[model samples]
Target: MTSTRATVDHYERLAASHDHNWTHSGVFLDWMTSQIVSAASIGATDRVADVGSGTGLFARHIADQVHPAQPILCVDTSRPMLTQIPTSPEPQPVVAPAEEMAEWVTAGGGAGTAGELDVILLKESVHTR
Candidate 1:
């Protein structure tokens, strides 16, 4: 497993350029994210958590499917990466490792029970950790 500190350091270094780099994903990202959201059965009442949320690109896209109050938890190891997430109504940014994602989810007013999360999304950010 990757050490949390190393993971954080690596993402911190990349945070500034993350959005630009992600632009290449473009239409593919849109299609992939749509499929994931549809398959996950995410709804307005469901509490969604985007693990390894990076700059919240996927989180924001997924948020569009849910209501503003549903909340999309943006969990990332690097604070810099979290900060790169554009200001949005649905994404609630949390600086934490993937293992601690549940804790952050509960703290954010989610159901806090196993299998209670509506969606736990991991884009290209998981392999780094």
Candidate 2:
């Protein structure tokens, strides 16, 4: 198993360059947007939580698919990655670890139940979870 410390270190190291690479890569951006849009369409009204939401790319793409003003939490352990997310006067970004996600939701008055999500996007970071 990958230790928590190691995982954090790995992500922290990569976070700085992740956004740059993704931003310039058209293929990756297209694929990510497609995936997020598809996921959002299936779970129309529920709040979405994106784990390892690096730079909020997927989260931002799916924002319009959700309710006009519903919340979407973007969780990432790396502050640098979170900082790189494109600014949107619309969707907000939150920086936190994926493992602590349940607490973050409950604190926001959500049910905190597994599979209760209308949409839970793991994206390309599922292996980290």
Candidate 3:
């Protein structure tokens, strides 16, 4: 099993260059993002939480789908990696391991489980904790 500590440490080391290493051509990113957004049927009004939102590789692209006034919760364990995400399009960073994501969002994340977040995108960081 993959330890959560190991996963967080691994990502922490790669934080500085995470975006550069994962990013592809604009066309490719757009295409990929479109596929995910479409598959999820994300709408402008949907409350979205992007778990493991490393460098916002997908979060940034899905911004337009969620309302401009609202913010996408970018959850990641690595602070440096979250910092790498751009400010534009507006993402609120939540520093928490993937396993704790749900608790953070609903309990401490201030959104309240009122209706629950409409969408949660858990791309790439599904470690066995």
Residue pairs that clash (backbone atoms under 3 angstroms), model 1: none
User: 19-126 in candidate 3: lDDT tens per residue?
Assistant: 788557988888888898889998877778888787877888888544534677788777888998877656778777666776655564554323367789988765
lDDT of 2: 0.63
Off by over 4 Å in 3: 1-6, 64-67, 105-115, 126-128
Q: What pairs collide in candidate 3?
A: none
lDDT: which candidate is best?
A: 3
lDDT of 1 by residue, 22-114 (tens): 555667777877787788887777767788888888888777655635568887777898898777665888877776666545665435433
What is the Cα-based lDDT of residue 64 in candidate 3? 55
lDDT of 1 at 121: 79
| Deviation in Å, model 2, residue 97 alpha carbon | 2.1
- Provide the lDDT at 126 for model 2: 38
TM-score of each: 0.77, 0.65, 0.80
Model 2 agreement with the true structure over 58-99: per-residue lDDT tens digits? 677666544434556676767777877766653446666665
Which candidate model has the greater lDDT, 2 or 3?
A: 3
Q: Given candidate 1, what's the lDDT at residue 3? A: 49
CA-lDDT, candidates in order: 0.73, 0.63, 0.75
